[model samples]
Target: MKLCFMMLTDLSKRFNFMNSTFQMANGYFEKHEKDLHQLSDQIWDNPELAFKEKFAHDLITDFFIEAGIGTVTKNYILDTAFKVEYVTGKERSDSTISESDLPCVAFFSEYDALPGIGHACGHNLIAVVGIASFLKLCSSLKATGTPARVILLGSPAEEGGGGKIKMMNNEALSGVDFSLMGHPSALNCCTSTITQAMEEKRATFHGKNAHGTTPWMGNNALDAAVLAYNNINTLRHWMHPSMRAHGIFTDGGKAPNIIPDRAELLYYFRAPDKKQLKPLLERAEQCFKAGADATGCTVEICEKSEAYDSVIQNPVLGRIYEKHMENMGYQFPPKDEKTFRGSTDMGDVSRAVPAIHPWFLIPCGGAPGHSVPFAKAAKLPQSFKNAMDSAECLAKTALEVLQSKQLFDEMKRSFKETCG
Candidate 1:
């Protein structure tokens, strides 16, 4: 009977500690709510393109400095990328703990906006959520003496630039054990569908130009481009249901009366995984070659961007985050329910470290992503409220990972089994 009572008491204390930590974080966010909202608005008002997020980058890094957090700007050779670190726990006089030895948790902030639509993907909200969570965690750690390190990474060019891959090449996540961030979406749910690997291919067909009246005198490049498009379309019937291939003609011809000297088609090929992507790419290249052979036009295929790998959500991390957000009053759909499907540079980060890119629903009235209406939805009052809740949930999850070695170990084991 005594042992049972003691066990109950310990459990009670643990619950109290968790509750207090969450309360502290929530209070911190509430106290700085106005500033966070202002920053979000500022980022929204000035939408920057991939790798050109100078305004947003400066705003975030400056905010970190003002908050007394240590920051390193222009990290990993990316001009717009920055890193912020906050340490908490008993201060060690001797140099016992190396930077790499300490358990490091990372949060990614994506501020680059979409072209023409401006914040259409709610990256403004994403940026603020990551920053706010990091700030709140910093406060919690300082107040509670939780021995851990937190990093806020400003990852730009998530739209298509593969900034995370570049950072990985530079060893940005060398010592990081875990990475996390929340994406604003129409539904609040843990990711069920894995993002596919994507690669961009551009095929340019070159041929001799001559008068249209004398068709035999010149090879028609437009005909080659059109045939290539049809070939890809026909290849679609043989492709797996999960495979996606789409393209657009960038240049068909300058005038209708002249045989086109050159034509170009840009395509994006996506597969469920990188292994499958390679074969699909081979087949796609063959389609382009077939067009060249049929039209007697030479073809040049060039890779436009780095291939993006599929996101591998660490299951342990996902469950912990799902629980925290649900405890914060967010209802999530079942795993089998339909959810949004898209790719992110977070996919690359996950491959490098245990990561979770949970999606939090902003009250967007069911608007689709990357649209003008979605951009407007990002500024709504309800969206800010949801953003605050997401911040708390993210911070809470990070606290769990930081404070519990068993939990962190479980996350790592799961990452290796699933990701490997």
Candidate 2:
């Protein structure tokens, strides 16, 4: 009897993969593959920084307008941010679909590029993934007149700026029921992270300026800076492998002959999760404070930018996505293999809503992200298709939620357990 039940469960999954809506989603992706590539290429061709993705923003918004899939709202929350919202469910004489029948879902796109390497992080592909995913789901919704809604949100400044965090503070994501996005990597995986909890810190040391020849006349801020650097280096010996605290002296002094009155240092601290992150940051703060105490220089330490939280992957949502990807013939890596995706503002998004940040393999020839080779690899044909397939699977996962209230409840329960 147990064997029969297992067999039936497997058959049900297979049936879901073979169903009409699944085909329709995949078909929409295939039909728009060229256009999708062009959009990604255009973003790659024109690299824009965070809060300054006007070109990419205008391009995507116009594309959505031309597609006529939903209502396009440009500059929705931030200057470069935009959203396309489609109400897929409505009353129809041929069907009994209702607007509130299913939970509202959202897909995110990040288009900002690194300053030195254009699209080196493969965010161009990320933008494509979001668009492709939304299109797939939107196509199915239109076809079946399903009782649900899907949104495509373009978030900017993900490279270093916390654009998503700003959007959340402004209540942009308040009403969204579920959120989904995928990142590009050398290997495909179900979760990018619990990625990492990360924060930026800036320190300014104040002291009296004195000639180098008269060393004892005034306090040396530069000395404090050096002490802080060494102290942080020392702290690393006791840090966990998953944690990071790296920094540099942005300002040392004007001349070798003078002891500068002011010095500045910038750092980024990261941990696997927020619990570990807080203590790591606190201990590191003491290291800086000790430097100031030793050098007799006053130190002011504060956040340089918005802090990003670690992602809490929704297990129930992940299982649904895995089945769809597996059915499409994509292989998963062993559980022990380490897939390192750096920090993201999407981590902040996950804390506010149930979310998944899957990583898909792009042909990078073993070059890690944020490099020239990875940037070139991102433009390859195969990379674009891989992103599309991942988007299709994400769309399938959304369809699963749209069909069952029980599934959405399970997702909510899992979210509470994982995040709390």
Candidate 3:
């Protein structure tokens, strides 16, 4: 590890010597700024839901192919989710360089949208950033003789479906030393502490149905669902500050005149970590049971999604990203008492490997995320600029990981030490 650090330090000096080259590389990407914005706008205009992003997947993958990066073995993973690799200086006459000998860096790109709002989560920005960064890095490496391999990860279904998780399970991230991705947000941050642990639950209440006029003869399923909701609402006051619970009635009652024979709901439960999640989930179940008992209804609670753990940031890699962004003329906002605390499937990936999912500030002012307004601004020119900026930063950070063995070793040690 120490020897790797020495080599990395030497490489860092070499990187510094290429400041002019870096400028040219960035300029190369800047030339495509207009096309990047148009692609982002097109994606936003036609949003696809989770696991069904045919348009987004095709657009991004086709762009990469046009950029000269070859697609890797992604059929092993989901069809929509694939990997693209760019290997520098494949010998004109001989080609026998093993992938293991080459340091691998990855950029995770998501392009799924919300049901009605479309790009509300700014996945369009994410996809454009990843593609632009990969292209820029490819150009830089080909020109500067940089010795590394760049991999772009096409991750889908971030809207509640575990696409990355499944990708990891399929060993798509194997042989990758470092992963880098950015989220479009209202403020800049090197690390996002918003990764809360999460669990999804679904419940259905069965009761007797009769005409509303003969209410005395019917057991109202709607009544049971309402009671359950109230119980969970009441439970919120006593839950830990880190704990969060919310739900919506999927089926309250079909008609006003008829008694509600069936009532259904989808509930989301969040905690600081999985250890705390267990007890909180149990309490929620008890509330469901209590509602059933009180309303004389039969209730069944089913776990929808497995508990997703909080994101674990690799400090070493995070600082490296911070350096890259600073070099690219960017700064993060001051840390506040109220940090971002959202939940994501990427948290699952962090648990298995060293990772960082930082938030890049879009032009959208401290606006509420995952909202319609946020979606609209995410398609603007300013958002495209920020996305391109993040792409460069993320690409540079990945380069640091590839060239600097010290950073990679520290990230590995940190991940193992923390997980163990």
* Every candidate's lDDT: 0.81, 0.83, 0.77
- For model 2, give the RMSD to the true fold: 5.0
Q: Number of clashes in every candidate structure?
A: 0, 0, 3
Q: Could you say which candidate leads in TM-score? A: 1
lDDT of 3 by residue, 105-172 (tens): 67788888998888888999988887787777766766655556778888888777778877888788
Q: Judged by lDDT, which candidate is best? A: 2
lDDT of 2 at 409: 74
Q: For candidate 2, lDDT tens digit of each residue in 56-127?
A: 999999988886668899999898999898875454322443434435889999999998899999999999
TM-scores of the candidates in the order shown:
0.91, 0.89, 0.90
Query: Would you give me the overall lDDT of model 2?
Result: 0.83
User: Model 1: per-residue lDDT, tens digit, 30-101?
Assistant: 676788999999999999999999999988888766766655565436988888877665363124655556
Q: Stretches of candidate 2 above 4 Å error? A: 1-18, 25-31, 93-102, 212-218, 336-340
Error of 2 at 206 (Å): 2.3
Judging by TM-score, tell me the better candidate of 1 and 3.
1
Off by over 4 Å in 1: 1-15, 25-31, 90-95, 338-340
Error of 2 at 248 (Å): 2.2
